[model samples]
Target: MPRGKQTDTKLTLVSQFFYPDTSANANVLSELAVGLEERGFDVSVVTGQPAYAPNDRRDDQPRREMYKGVAVRRIFSTRFDKNESTVKRMANDVVFFLSAFLHLLFKRDEMGVLLLPTAPPFLPILGWMLSRVRGYEYVPVVLDLYPDMAVELDYLSEDGVVYRVWDQLNKRAYQAASLTVTIGETMEETLTEKYGPCETAVVHNWEDGSVIQPKEKANNEFSRKHDLVDPTTILYSGNHGMHHDLESVVEAAATLEDSREEDLQFQFIGEGGRKVTLVRMTKDRDLDSVSFLPYQPVEQLPESLTSGDIALVSMQEGVEGLCVSSKFYTAIASGQAILAIANEETEIARIVEEVNCGIRVDPKRPGQIVSAIEHWLDNPDEMRAMGERARSVFEERYEKEEAIDRYATVLRRVTT
Candidate 1:
């Protein structure tokens, strides 16, 4: 609470999601909080109640709980139905945004530095307002570029009034922040161009190496349990959301169905907006080689990931700089050869090319995806070598420790 001694005060992280939640946001934030605490910084997290899974949703979680040595305070917010309308989802975001704002507003004195991410997408504006009012530094960690993403996803039109208003708010929020932290170089470039040059840092999302390491497919328990013993599995794991070009993966599966005689399977293991559509398409096409599974628990991640010979990570063409899929890092860590379907200029493409860990193909072309798969199928040795290179890159550049250290240093510098 004293001037010039910010480290003594707790650093507060504001997020709509946090520990014990299964989403990538929660998991990554948990790692960062624990790492900061280990670096001798007092940390507290202000987050919404855990309800990542369907059955886990509750009216409220305990007001406070300690998770991985980080003190967490959960705010009571409205829970929207899973089948709810977009209006309801926005309402949920609004309710949580306000709840988090008022909670942080009252407790501002106890906190030294405020760190927030774009989960609800507009919540960082609240943090910016509080920083202006209470004189504490607010750092906006941009996981996704909003208004742009909303427009790209067809949720909003670029020329619409809603989009204009949201874009203005976004600019103001970024301009007010003491520093802006985003995930990738493409995102950094986009933010700077749109928001007009703020102090930005690009710290990539990383994999928890200890939890997700390379394992032989034959030795993987998940594969054995699911009877996925065949080595010709091409896995697409993670959020099968609208931003991902998963439909093309299905198209590729259909394209190769008759040509390939091997027992090849295209496995998708996660839930998202696109998952249902992908499932229906796979069923409608009668693609027996394609399979779907619910998201596995965090403990089963390594086995589930390693079960695949090659991992398919994709992003839609126009949504390149908005957000990079975190699954790419996990795939890298799992030592599975990656076939990235993304824009060539994006960060994922750059990383895959730089590390020599994967192949990047045009997201729009299913034929290219099919060709890449067939090539890997024929040259197993080359694929294995690519996977090894991916693991090496994961260790050298995208490990949890490196990302945490970068975050910790940024937090410390801002506080000082």
Candidate 2:
């Protein structure tokens, strides 16, 4: 794990989404790839074109390019609307897997220490298969646990054959990985409890504090344009997927509207499967206080994130440890007080308690959410103090450089 030994190590990161794709996994992987390159490793990325980005932003990028010194190889895959249907999204995943597999197989000689992320869920299994064929060492980064999430969301039955097969495949992948990286301690616990012990590291997801630091909403362009400067905004920014308890938040918004809370506003920014439904609910209730906006560009993150007085982070009731929201890091980085809608056992809840950053309410509890919001509204000084503490905790523990360095250490340990 010496610095000198890292120069000879070649790392290839395989993910379905990468630069130009606005997905959370893509942004994290891209940053890691670039960071590793700067640390004297020959790093390359194999990723697909933009699928999660907005239509206007999803341009047809080149097949190959160099991004911030990291070699990027974009593979051809079906660009279906992921938010439209689950079947179409699966098809996209399938094509990307096959394309990535073939590309890696043909260039097997160039493959080195593989850094595979659990984006499409099949990527780690593909890594396991490739490592078997090429004798390459792979490190699987567990962003989301697959069958567990599916079962928790009630999308798949635990007694079903497909669930069993997927679970077994995941076991093989984790068992074969040189080192498995998880984003949170709860996730590490879940992995160990489910698949027994293995080489694991808990590297929390991060955001660049230098770029996403607190900004004044009065002077921020994104805030001004979106008319967020006047309202006491409670923002829910990020994916509105099934795993998130966003519907309950929407219901809370309805209650707040009924109570004629004019000064308070609920702003939902980003896209996901439940977006359409949330929009419909807002319309049906005629909730003028609730607003929806598309995902903003990365450059505007500072303004976009700081527009909120309180940031809402949630996960479905049963999916406490399955996945940790990356938005939590950004929310803290933006110096916004958090309103976590998750179980007390979850990582977000733990962080909220430890940092004294915000409040934690149970999932599907709209009444609790409303009460928490009211408390924040009444105690503005406490809310601002919590936001300050949140930013302090982010800088002390979850900054970008610290996380990238930890990943570099993990890679060097695995490769060496």
Residues 342-409 of candidate 1 have per-residue lDDT tens digits of 98888889989987888999988999999998998889899999999999999999999889888877
- The sequence of per-residue lDDT tens digits that candidate 2 reaches over residues 263-329 is 8789999988889999999898898889999888788777888898898998889887889999899
Q: Give the candidate number with the greatest lDDT.
A: 2
Per-model TM against the reference = 0.95, 0.96
**Can you give the lDDT of residue 127 in candidate 1?**
73
Compared with the true structure, the alpha-carbon lDDT of candidate 2 equals 0.87
Error of 1 at 123 (Å): 1.7
| Superposition error at 341 for model 1 (Å) | 0.8
Candidate 2: residue 275 Cα off by (Å):
1.0
The TM-score, computed over Cα atoms with residue i paired to residue i, of candidate 2 is 0.96
